[model samples]
Target: MALLEVDHLSVTYTPRDQPANRAVHDVSFHLSEGEFVGLLGESGCGKSTLGNAVLRLLSPPAHITGGRVAFDGVDLTEADDEQLRKLRWVDLSTVFQSSMNSLNPVIRVQAQFADTFAAHKVPGDVTERATELLELVALDRRVLRAYPHELSGGMKQRVALALALALRPKLVLLDEPTTGLDVVVQRGILTRLAELRRELGFAVLFISHDLGTVLEMADRVMVMYGGEIVEDRPAAEMLREPRHPYTRGLLGSYADPRLPDVRVSYIPGRPPDLSRTHAGCLFTTRCPHAEDPCRTIHPDLLPDRGGLVRCLVAQENRLPVVTLGSAEAATVLGSHFPATGSLDRPADAADAAPVLTVERVSKRYTSRRGMRTNTVEAVRDASFALRPGRVTALVGQSGSGKSTLARLVTGVERPSSGEVRFTGEGGADVRVDRLRGRALRDYRRHVQMVFQDPFSALNPTRTIAYALSRPLANFAGLRGAAARERTAQLLESVGLSPAGQFLDKLPHQLSGGQRQRVVTARALAPEPRVLIADEPISMLDVSIRAEILELLGDLVRERRLAMLYITHDLLSARLLADEVLVLNQGTLVERGATREVIGSARDDYTRLLLDSIPNPFGKAAGQQTLPST
Candidate 1:
């Protein structure tokens, strides 16, 4: 029997005056006992909505208008609040995307677990149970007393996982559990999660935008798009042969950073409009295999003799050609990985004339925890120079001072150390470090920074039109229609279709990838000579990752923007870098041409780093998956 089952489940969200927004529809699926199920899709594609519906956490305006939800033999659709409360922690739980927000910042970590146990009335020593749970996630026992703020993002996420498993629930719903974390942290978490499942024997409904991680952990996989389950199958089999066109489109959207650059096809149209009824295949607008019949008729999701397919093309082919694109992509990358492209040559004296340079920059902050005066060296003795029309990657693990270096270079923070120099495009020697007051403002105009999280970076209260226009109005002094027109042009350039579709929407309304594109477009508003992207693609999925990477590459070649690509992902750094700088413990350990550093990795740390990169092929390829934060 299935551990949990949902039949014809559809969820709708509507404001009092607004049209009904269907978050998920006809999302029928079942999780068998001890099976690991993955719900994979792009952001804003109902992945999170499905996770929320499973937990009955849909807020106001969201109602389960149709469907039946069964946990084992009991129907949850009619369960009372008291019944839900009883089942929640003991039989069902969730580990959210943002663990920082998931935990109560004011409460101690141990106390939160105590609350979980108390709510469930599971009858256990709360501290001991919490400790056991913490051990399961590889967290230390001492973390029990620490407040949410004291822990790192990874630490906090693991703590959240521990709390979710405090009562050893039969089913755990995980939503993008490792989205923002670096490599090492993600592997640690996924490993522990696997071990926990083995020991506890609980089924999981894993939700993520990352296909790689999902393939790594899940027993079964479900693909969702436009409020529906387009495909579902066993993890190993589906990864080997994805039959649905929508699934193929999802996979084909971008080149894997770990692999080489090849011709990638982007989904041409936006997802179907759910407010209006979709009588045809929901993905027909973007499907390359789409024929005349698709738009006129809807597809049913059902189990077939070949496998689970939800498309007419899928029924025709029976088994998809799992294109050995990556192998070809890998072979191309192997050929390209060692050779300097048309842009980047080996670092020599000729390449030393820097476009933007920072020498011995430092930033310090005082400890907030009453250590009686200890300083945090956010950026210490950090020095790197970005060459003209070439990507220089500044890479280090988290807390190794990458973002602080960005803040210092962007002039958002004053340096505590030496100097910054910029050779102006029009050929002026500008000492960025010595610039004071208004001079610093001029320096800021020449160099721009693109942040990682687009939502927090943008002014949420402002519309996309206003936010994009602000940069133009301030930098170029364009007002009214001119600014609006320029904003539309920029949006169109960044791959947001038509531009008008997004202009009036707020930051929250756009998906993560679209929001990121807006951030890039805003940075380009002033047409700055140098662009410093701080872990820009780290938060994105592999599909959208290629888009952003390609965009940056095109921007560098077309606009001659000096690119500073800061990231923790090695393959990304290698693929995007002209010259690579490996930073460890706030010191430059390896610095040279991209090919040189990657092919003949010099430092042990650099070698260790190269060793840690997660391979999409599988662990059998001898690649390590990063720790899940």
Candidate 2:
């Protein structure tokens, strides 16, 4: 028997007045012993709901409506509250999206483990288990006594994972476990998770928005849309040839560094409505190959090749590559230059006026541990400038303080000591540090920021309408109807389709990518002169990251918005940036043109980072001794 089998599982959530909201609809899949399966979709397509349903964590107003969820032949769907409580952590464990917040802040980490053990009537040497698990996650045992605040984001996630494995359950469900972490940290955690799976011999249901990570970790993959599994296949076979038009669009939508940037496209619209009753293919509205049949008939999951597809057109028509010819690049890439969008729009010339200038800006913070205060310098005299309509990227290792620089630039925190001069504000120049109150707010209006995780950045309670309107009302003085129409325009501009549906849905209702799109729309609503995107795509999959980047790039060129692209990724910098600044240990190591920096590196630390980027093209990491500049 399979370790876990979810047959035709359906979950629904309902508000007081509205109809039942189907989060998962007739999704069926099974995992064998020690096997791995990935549930892939955009943010709102019900992957997490499926994970929650399997774990029996779906709260009031949301419940399993249909089908059987069997774990090792015991019906989990029918399992009562007490049965679920006993089964969880001991028999089936789940690492939730917000697992970092799972720990009790008042209780010590070791005590938390002790509670779990005591409840289970298992051996209570919690320290040993905690130490072993910490070692497994590459964390020091000293963290056992520390609270969650003491741990870094990556460290907290590791601790959460260790707790999930404390019982060594037969099944482990991971929901976007590596969502907000940087690439290096993400890779490390995934490797550890893979090791845990092998060591414990547990079945995995890994849910992620990033297709690349899913393809890397999963044995089999399923593409979900509007609460249904639209496609299913072996991860490799699916990546090789996805049959569903929605699946094809999803695969093509995001730019994976492993693949070349060309031949990429996006789904023209947002996902389907879960609350509205529909008798069609869930993805028909956004699908390019949708026919009359698609809108009228609901397709069933039937055998295709290696797995299954749930679209009549997909069953009949072979999937297309959805290649972008020269015209596609012209409308997008040409905006970077003068000829495509506007004639006098200006190319990235050396003579362009510099907007925001940073000269030797560095920040440091001291940690007090028993009176021995160790000063940790975050930024090391990092210097760069945003030119007319060009992108300047900050590339570095995790703690090198790309975020610190962003905070400094946006006046979130004053730098420890350094100069940041504004040169070409049409004679409206002001030092970033000295700018106070009104000046700071004015400066902020000129510069907007986009965060990594699309979901959390947005307010879950508010509709997208409210979110996109806040900036316009606060920054631009537009309110009421003015704000609403402007919100629609901003939504369309950011590529969230229809714009009508998004205005009503809450943040949790959207997918990770779409929530991010709404965030971008909010940032753009203020009509800022500078857009500071901090690791914007680090939380996204390979497929969707490029789409968001392209959106930003398009805005930069077409709207002439100066962009500060801050990230730890060298490859993304190469693709999106005109200039790149390399930071190491809170210090600026090098700055040059993107092509120049990537091609000829004079500094060892810069080269280390450039080399660190996984060569998606599969080239050997070059060995050229770089000097400490």
**Every candidate's CA RMSD:** 4.1, 6.0
Q: lDDT of candidate 2? A: 0.75
Indicate which candidate wins on TM-score. Answer: 1
Quick one: how many clashes does candidate 1 have?
Answer: 11
TM-score of 2: 0.84
Could you tell me the lDDT of residue 268 within candidate 2? Answer: 47
TM-score of each: 0.89, 0.84
Alpha-carbon local distance difference test for all models: 0.76, 0.75
- What digit string (tens of lDDT, one per residue) describes model 1 on residues 297-394? 88888675445778876776643355433444233322311222223322233264678889887777877666587887677687888766788898
